[model samples]
Target chain A: MSSSTKHSKWRYVLLGVTAWLAAFMIPQAAHAEYGDVVINNYADAAGIRPAVFPHWFHRIRFRCKVCHADLGFQFKAGGNKIDMAKIIDGKFCGACHNGEVAWSVENCAMCHSGVPGTPTHFHGSTVQSLIAPAYKPLEGK
Target chain B: MKNKIILTSALALVISGPAFSADGVSAEEVTASAATPEPVVVAQVAGANVFNRNLKKVKVKNAPPPEDGIHDPENEGTYVLQPPLEAYQGLPTSPYGNYVDWVKAIDEKKLQPRWDRIDSSEEAFVMDLDVLREVKASVPDVIFPHRQHTEWLACSNCHPAIFIPQKGANQINMSGILLGQKCGVCHGKVSFPITTKSCKKCHSQPKPEDWTPPLSEATLKNPWR
Candidate 1:
């Protein structure tokens, strides 16, 4: 192969790699999608991956009030103060996750499954994304 | 000397690297546990079901018209059928229940949900009665409207099983609702969800400071008289 042809091929490879990297970065800047909460409160210090809560998955099976009202999950992200010890103790997340209603804590990978070094808060969280479209008063109408 | 030992161990963590095991724990966690007792290194699974990464499992939502399981690949007409995503583009949207806002659609007269499926001779029984539920909380009291519910449901839907026809017979509370009872039977599942944003939708009537329970129909009517 001619030296110029080899150089042009290498240039194209470099351009392709740079474009791929840029494509990945744009989504990262948006910083997480709606209905996902990355809980890193204690995971990094303990060397475990951050727990990524999928609100979408749970919402599909169960109702909003099930967790929020009955199980006592606060509306704000990072507000519940979830810990592995508490989960094992059969509180908060353990209510359903005690090897019966859902998967138990021993199945650690499912909940504590996130890329290392991820921050505690997820941007574009559910509450912020789905704020009341303004209260429509229907009573006494 | 201790600093040197700690530094060397920290470096060892990097050198040993993360373990990819069938079980989701890292080999690093098992070995490093003696030194750092609570350390738990998770096996890194790329494209894990995090951040709705379940979508990564299936590249496209629906296969192209030719390969879609429902469509007959041999037929040309199957290829020309409207794509599902494109067919739903312009309608009003809600965050839940498949993202379509049927309530607003009805208000705008875009789509009518029901074309009187009941026998045309028998007019739909539409009740306009409102039952006030006086709550002890400082928040506004709840007003259950029969008009809205009866429009979609027959009286038999909730009568003997879910709720007895007589007042104060069936007990109700927030916890019961959360546990998929009474109002929650439909509200959180199919209808609008019981979210913080939607609290006022049900809890609308302002409670009176000197509120008293209303009398029963039997006590007031005295049918014989």
Candidate 2:
């Protein structure tokens, strides 16, 4: 009933809210969504689904230079003007994903999972375990 | 005399007040802030002052009769000359000639004509810039053999200026090239004219289906070599 007690309760409520928001705002290393780069250059506005490029999945297999330097990909996401037209032309992402290389470019939903409720194909506990033992966080004592 | 001095000072302030107020900004600085290029300024000045709007009314001397087809008043007498086919004959039908033969000949001191400075006197080095774009196009894909071009021109002639080195930066197409952009900057003018039915000169290689991604360095090597 006291004013000091009321103020203490208010402070606790504010701290709890702050902690909850921080959990969502800060990027988590273990999560697949952490390094996801949204490529909405022409997709979102044009009614097509924007692509969510998973950096974490690709980084495990290939070096940065393979895509960035050798393939002439701009360092920043969406920096290179990528479109379906150019992709089909065997440029940009199409360089490696041209059916014969890694995966077919025809598989749209594999990358274009930015639409709400769209299930990401790579998000699973089994895939997380496959990320190698070195990348995992240190365990508690 | 005091009134004359005051009037003169007022006139001087009116004449140079903006320049002084601008914190050392010159006339060039004002124009440069707009980021206008020198050629645009020259054109505007020439149109407004030198040539004047009245110049359009004046009749040009020895103007060709209207009956002449394809008369360009701007170029006047200058004509786009077709590159002689004889110049390319006997040269390797393949891009950059036979690289091995040329190198072997060089070692034996029997390389004919040599990689001489015909287009430029400066030292030019061979570089591979073969890019495979438009694989599905009707004709063969382009293998932009730099050795073929570098044999004549310098690196400074194209890099970072005319053609940006970044891949996919320059959207090259036949229409744009014909419009004097990209390759048209020189091809139609100083270099070989594209209209001479020399399409195969560049697009010589066919699209290799099942062509592996991450082009192997072996393919990048001089095909002639």
Candidate 3:
């Protein structure tokens, strides 16, 4: 009766990260929503806000391969090693961000609008959610 | 970013929703797309960011055709078209893209997605193989169903490109997907955003119970055959 194990705070962090907010967030609306990713790798050193990739905005218009395959964008957030140089040179995001395809990379605030201290991750989705048999505190054990 | 270019010259392209024809779409893919793929730049103002606002949030979803972001709200002609909310009525729903369960609808014959654009008579080269990626210690193994994807996509869409078409040829993991490499390419983007609710959707294979491998006869201290 005395065998009680204390759960770590990190576990709660994972739980909070994956906690489904849509159930409570939806206020009488059947809307479309996709995950957003935040990339902060370079911004920390570059003295700029983290970039917020609205994947849904792009994905809605093209196939996954167009960016991931043809454009050579890595699937993971921040995995593309994006920078202004590459964008100006027309590499990763510059492929479409150019004024011709969509918008030019000169629009810094467009992507770099993310919060200052965000980590590189899928905005709403977290690793703990994708893993099966997701952690659940045993009920009334 | 929500500026209106309803009466502009580009309205024709914007109204049809071309340039971003949404791959894996159903049979209704009108070859309205241009030769070179481009963003849906139908109504962007000069010097303006393509997406001026955050992508995660939408003010109104599935509104009437006249008021929907893509439609020409000022034009009375646009109002003649049925609203998405009405069209989506009595259909299967999901918590993702358009909130329609297109897969279930397709399976139930309510939707018949063609396999090709040029060949109307062509049947999908549907494959039924399921590859299991084992993840021991925690989480169930992932079950890759070829049939579901092949029905919507083609061999060229993935084979030897995103993934090699051979056993043990490709390396896959959640990290890569989270990084937007493997399955992350489509999922968590257009198809279905990754969520805790969908973990079992892909990670479907049940893990084997705790057990040891079969012991060799030599290990039993008997003359092993």
Candidate 4:
């Protein structure tokens, strides 16, 4: 085959490959899934891991208006002025967690357990992991 | 060659002059014809846009009025608030199931409210029971006329579930209600669209003074009998 003809054939093959790759990449980019809660406020400021709240779990227990409207929680994270003192005084977490309505705040280490160099283990599993175990089939007969 | 060229030019001018001026056309005629076509196209586009806008408004207006009449099962999906309780069967059970089962089931077309159908109102009355109770402990239990509501609803509309069959069994709380478990199923979405009037709807009762005619008649007739 002539050199020019060979070059043209190779160019067509490259174009085809590029077109195929472009089609495949578009959908993945468009529908990429990301974590719902991105705690950029406290951690980025103090160089530590800020608390990551999973909406999927909390929503199961209570309604959005109960906390948002009734308890005065702001819509955006970091917007609400949450502090340890208020929680202990039964303002935010204390409202329910006074050992009656929900989990108590007596165990400070539950939320603030992280140390500087040691690896921190937040006890509860992710929403997916917690739900997955519940759905497993019963053990063999 | 020069004589032939001159003869051809003279013939062309004579032929064109008569055709160009035959009806004595003016510049205005030429301009008007050119300008006319542009407006017709612009008018057509404008008409199309108006038609689309009107259609959108109509669909939106019609949608919520009917879905709002009955309880909404999920936060998602289109709805209206009409009466006489049409059911939307086959919806999955709400993760939190406090809504009247009839209303919830209606979403799945499983059950229908037993009532006559009526046009839903754009404006809804709000009933805030909390504030009402604070004001008067002896407040009359609001006699919500079920028959009136059924004019636009069905039997399964608020039965066998949303309200427990055993009267007074379902003690609704704010926390449980908000999770779309109990009364929240219909209040926020359908059935009088709960608001400030919610208290009046559920709590307001017929007063003793208001009961003069019927009670007085019975009392006078029987005495001690």
The lDDT of model 3 is: 0.58
Candidate that scores best on DockQ: 3
Give the higher-lDDT candidate: 1 or 4.
1
Candidate 4 predicts chain B with a TM-score of: 0.28
Tell me the lDDT of model 4 at B6. Answer: 48
lDDT of 1 by residue, B61-113 (tens): 42333342222234444344444345345667776433455446544645433
Candidate 3 chain B minimal-lDDT segment of 10 residues: B27-36
Each model's DockQ score: 0.02, 0.01, 0.06, 0.03
Q: What lDDT tens digits, residue by residue, belong to model 2 across residues B56-123? A: 22112211211111111122121221112322233323222111222233234332331321221323
DockQ of 3: 0.06
> What's the CA error at residue B34 for candidate 1, in Å?
25
Q: Which ten residues in a row have the lowest lDDT in candidate 4 chain B?
A: B56-65
- The Cα error of candidate 2 at residue B193, in Å, is 2.0
Ranking by DockQ: 3, 4, 1, 2
Each prediction's TM-score versus the true structure: 0.36, 0.27, 0.42, 0.25
Give the CAPRI rating of model 1.
incorrect
Name the better of 2 and 4 by TM-score.
2
lDDT agreement with native, every candidate: 0.57, 0.49, 0.58, 0.39
Question: Which regions of candidate 1 fall more than 4 Å away from where they truly are?
Answer: A1-141, B1-96, B115-123, B209-225
Per-residue CA lDDT of model 2 for A33-62, tens digit only, reads 223355667775666565656543453334
Indicate the residue-level lDDT of B128 in model 3: 93
